[model samples]
Target: MSIISSTSHATSNTATLSQRLTAAIGASILGACLVYFAGFSHIEAVHNAAHDTRHSAAFPCH
Candidate 1:
């Protein structure tokens, strides 16, 4: 009985870990797509945004 319960518990933990991993992967892919689309849709806007950020940080973009 003890062995059976331990096995079951381990399987449950593995399933939970797998689900979390899948969710993380999905979120990363979605974020990448969003960034790609945003940059593609407005290349100049993105460039300006980065440029302003650099200037704000005093990076001497020129």
Candidate 2:
């Protein structure tokens, strides 16, 4: 009985870890899409803002 309980507890922890990892990956993809779109936006203000950010981060946008 104790072994069974411990096994279930480990599974629960694995599920929680999987959920957190999925969320992190999803958020990273969304953020990358947002940045890519904003960086290339036709709107000058948005494009410049992203460009400035790249410069600030020393990302070598040029």
lDDT of each: 0.75, 0.86
RMSD in order of candidates: 8.0, 7.1
Q: Please identify model 1 stretches exceeding 4 Å from their true place.
A: 1-15, 42-62
Tell me the deviation in Å of residue 37 in model 1.
0.2
User: Model 2, 1-62: lDDT tens per residue?
Assistant: 35554444444434588899999999999999998899779999999998998899999977
Please give the lDDT score at residue 41 for candidate 2: 97
Question: Which candidate wins on lDDT?
Answer: 2
- Best model number under TM-score: 2
**In angstroms, how far off is 27's CA in candidate 2?**
1.0
